[model samples]
Target chain A: MLNIVQRFMKRLVRQFFKKKKKVKIGLYGPPNGGKTTLANRICEDWLGEEMGSVSAIEHETREIKIKEEISVKSGKKELKFNLVDTPGIATKIDYEDFVKKGMSEKKAKQRAKEATKGVIDAIKWLDEMDVVIVVLDGTKDPYSQVNITIVGNLAARDIPVLIVCNKMDLKKAKKKKIEAAFPQYDVVPISAKTGKNIDKFYEALFVIAG
Target chain B: MSLTLQFVPYGEIENLDSTAKVNKLIKIVKEEKIILLEGRIEKNEETLLIKKTMEEIGPKFKGIELFVMYPKDEESDPIQRLKKSVVDMLLGNRQGLTIIGPATIVKEIRKDPDKIQLLTKNLSKRKKTPASRSKSTKKKTKTKKRK
Candidate 1:
């Protein structure tokens, strides 16, 4: 009789919490894929502030940053959610790579250590995401193992995904390649740095988050 | 400078659970051997393997390059596809090939409808040029020729 009562109470509490929770939108991709830049763009546009720092170096965002209660207006419709900017996921992180990029050996090792933890945290947080925006560097090949793994995880969880092909400002940015790589998801080509075609991304969010 | 390719039959890992199967593959990959697995693991297991790989990243062990190729159902007729599905249900879905290798060696794995390509990096040549000496050498040669 006690166990049955406990189960009933647990179900009621879960239902109440689920109704009160905000939709969590996650920014995920490989390192240096402009995830932070996009996060900053969204925060700046909606919340009137930046979310995190952006850098040219890989693994710069070594922690998960969340901006809550962002309300976006599209015409007469409005959507509200919490934005999550996760660390760039990578299968490999060698301190030697950082050393070659002009960091001291000690700092390189420290960055590498933090980066591995960041990847693990990003994967663990996947279960909490309501919608995920997969940011890919448009100048690079989209047919990579890291990209595959991220997409595969999202598919397994049945989460809605929007692929953002960032860096469309660059001459080498190939949006077509990204489209071909992930034909299932809606691909939005935008330059988060230059703020090009970002409006289209905002409009697409309504359909995806619906 | 030597490369090793270890072929793992489905029977070898048929009894192991997802974690053990991933661990076995990682152990072989950490030794710098390329694994050609007879069957592809589950999608969730692939994600688990990636999570484990991220945890194991360190100085000597960089990570892994993985790719799986399976036969497409679109090529078959509806009846043939149904038959294939029934067979798969009974015998397990072992109609795919999975390739996993250390990232230090295997650079990329490209796949098409009909074939797959595995690209490798030359570590010895890379070690010889601590920095990207090859690019600097090319620039020097170009300047000399111009002079």
Candidate 2:
């Protein structure tokens, strides 16, 4: 059929262009998992700028933001990639949750609408990523359904993954739990807020990207 | 006011493809029923299921909570593992349990190596009496006036 041939041509073009461009490193995780904080950390370390804003509220980064031409170095080796900061993926978006956080009902409804679209966008962007950094709140259980879904999608795509167990500065942050949950992937514990063990994260990035 | 738990055996959905299987599951969850599936789906199917759930989110239909529990092969002996592989090849992997529920009802689904614990939301807390509603409204008005 004409549609099948067109699809094949499109995929071929995408594959050819993918090899020509810089590696796209994506930050993906559940809502409020400190993805934007990690994005800011990476951008500030390399470009002396922040990618987006961070908030205590969930779904704060409800759009996909990208920082191009970020070249990370570990000793003499350097890896060049475009760092993509995606909205936190979630299965549910309730306006009442924002209202409970002291947002007006009208504003909460608007946020919920945007968040729903954000989740869809995040999923759609999964296929375009060359590498993904899955950020998890270290204090929470890593065996949640959302975490499994995110990791499973990456595995299915055969994309290299690096799981960052963030918020290590918190007393309740148990790095072992995340390690135990996902033994297949390399788990690096870091406090994105404090930049703790972030060097190790960059070091591990080279290994995975290689 | 009521909760429904739908038990679906593997035979019921064995013939369906991945998209069909996810669609069937989402259709049930959209009706606010918790599904206790006999066997676990593939990893890619789980991802597809989440994508479909996000697409269907709305005011009334929130989303779904999914969990799967299976026996760990690491704990089994080599012979036992071989037997499981053979059986799995013959009859599919029907040794695991999958739970999918509407997020409006299921608050969380916690799983360890051996068991699954499903925590439901407290629906009673959402019901407000007329007197309590009026009292809260009056408190809000007083705060607005003070502001």
Please tell me which predicted candidate would have the highest TM-score against the true structure.
Answer: 2
lDDT of 2 by residue, A162-203 (tens): 999999999999999999889999999999999999999999
Model 1 residue runs over 4 Å out of place are: A1-18, B76-84, B87-92, B112-115, B125-147
Per-candidate RMSD vs. true structure?
8.0, 7.0
Task: State the C-alpha RMSD over the true interface residues for candidate 1, after superposing those residues.
Answer: 1.5
- First chain TM-score for all predictions: 0.91, 0.91
**Candidate 2 chain A weakest ten by summed lDDT:** A6-15
Candidate 1 has a DockQ of: 0.52
lDDT of 1 at A114: 92
lDDT of 2 by residue, B1-147 (tens): 578999999988898999999999999998879999998888778877877887888777778888877546573688888987787778664777899999889988887656678899997775455877899899999999999
Q: How accurate is chain B of model 2, given as a TM-score from 0 to 1?
A: 0.79
Q: What overall lDDT goes with each candidate model?
A: 0.87, 0.87
Question: What are the clashing pairs of model 1?
Answer: none
